[model samples]
Target: MKTKITLLMFALLCVSTLANAQKKQKALSFISGKISIAKYHEREELNRMNKGELLDLYIERIEVIVNILPNIAFATNSNVTMSTLGIPDTKENRKALVENKEASDVYFENTIEFQKKILPYSDTSDLIAAILFYESTLKSLHTYNDFKSN
Candidate 1:
């Protein structure tokens, strides 16, 4: 009876741990998907900017800046800026900017003061990765838009 009780407790513990792990995995997946979608929008904005879409340029620039603002914030130790105006500092605000939307009147403005501090230590590969991320983001955004419009 003692041995059986011990085994049962062990099993319960294992199950609990597994359940927590699964929950964590789901959260990570959700965050990753959000980030991927944001990256996609930024890439599309970049392409649009390159195609001489002047009107879109302002918004696209904001989107790219917003998409990369987190990394920039970490790198530069500055506040994260928004791509839109009048948006509050919340996860929803960030999501909106990353997803499909136009300009926001309120932006979380931050100075790019850290550029000079970190640019010297930046790696060529990192730059390449950034480009790749932008491209991927663009592809994903286009695909999503096509799916939605169709």
Candidate 2:
């Protein structure tokens, strides 16, 4: 009787652990998909700018606007995940957030500088529109994923 009870408890523990692991995997997949969508949008925006298709004035403002949304999303997501994992969302505690902020700032600055240099050669409105579209798409994807997760 004692041996049977021990075996049942162990089996139950294993099943619970497996279920938790599966849940974690699902959450991770959702997070990965969100990150990938952001990256793809950023790359597409850069490609359009590099093609000299954006106008000077629009490129100048749009580049900054386009980069800001993704930066905010990344920061928000990082903080939320850290909190969910019961980790402190501090600069000293979260190295990934620190690194992400540094890299994103540099990228944002560089994109602006690059845009200024090429503004005279591209169509500003078109560049702005393209960036806006990408951002909107990213927002939609995030919303859909959030709903799906819930």
Candidate 3:
């Protein structure tokens, strides 16, 4: 009987532990979709938006992503780029985001810096979620290329 009680308590503890363990947030993919839509839906007009406008849009999305990141995207959002983060290099740019190895490398380098600042405040799961969004945004950027530049 004592063994049975101990086993039940152990099981309860395990269940609680699992429940409390870091769970990945859900909005990363959503943020990715937003970034993709913004980048791909319109290839040309995207460039006309002023830097402040562009940054504001990004900030809006990042704010939403950040709200979901730690419990988050600002501290870790510095590595944003024209290709990797789904922004266009130029009005006629036709580059891919994730598939473009060079672009991805540059993006990763930038993101690493943000991670350093964010890591002290967040868990692995949170960062992974942010990364998923980053990758998704990259994949989405390939949707359409208005014109190719040499």
The numbered model that scores best in lDDT is: 2
Instruction: Kindly list the per-residue Cα lDDT of model 3 for residues 1-150, writing each as its tens digit.
Output: 999999999999999898877553222211222222243223234355554444334334453333233311222232334445554354343333234435444555566567445554644344344444554654543442433444
Global CA lDDT computed for model 3: 0.43
Comparing candidate 1 with candidate 2, which one achieves the higher TM-score? 2
Give the per-residue lDDT digits (tens) of candidate 2, residues 48-137. Answer: 564443343344344434434554433334224556666665556566755665676687678768866865565555566665665565
Superposed model 1: Cα runs more than 4 Å off = 1-111, 146-150
Q: Best-fitting candidate, measured by TM-score?
A: 2
For all predicted structures, in order, the TM-scores are 0.28, 0.40, 0.23
Please give the range of 10 consecutive residues that has the lowest summed lDDT in model 1. Answer: 25-34
Which stretches of candidate 3 lie above 4 Å from their native place? 1-114, 146-150
List RMSD in Å for every model shown: 17.1, 15.1, 17.7
lDDT of 1 by residue, 1-150 (tens): 999999999999999999987662211111111222233334444443432232223334344545443443222212324422333546675565445322221232222234334544545444444655555654544344354443
2 versus 3: better TM-score goes to: 2
What's model 2's lDDT at 120? Answer: 59
For candidate 1, the clash count comes to 9
In order, candidate lDDTs are 0.41, 0.52, 0.43
TM-score of 1: 0.28
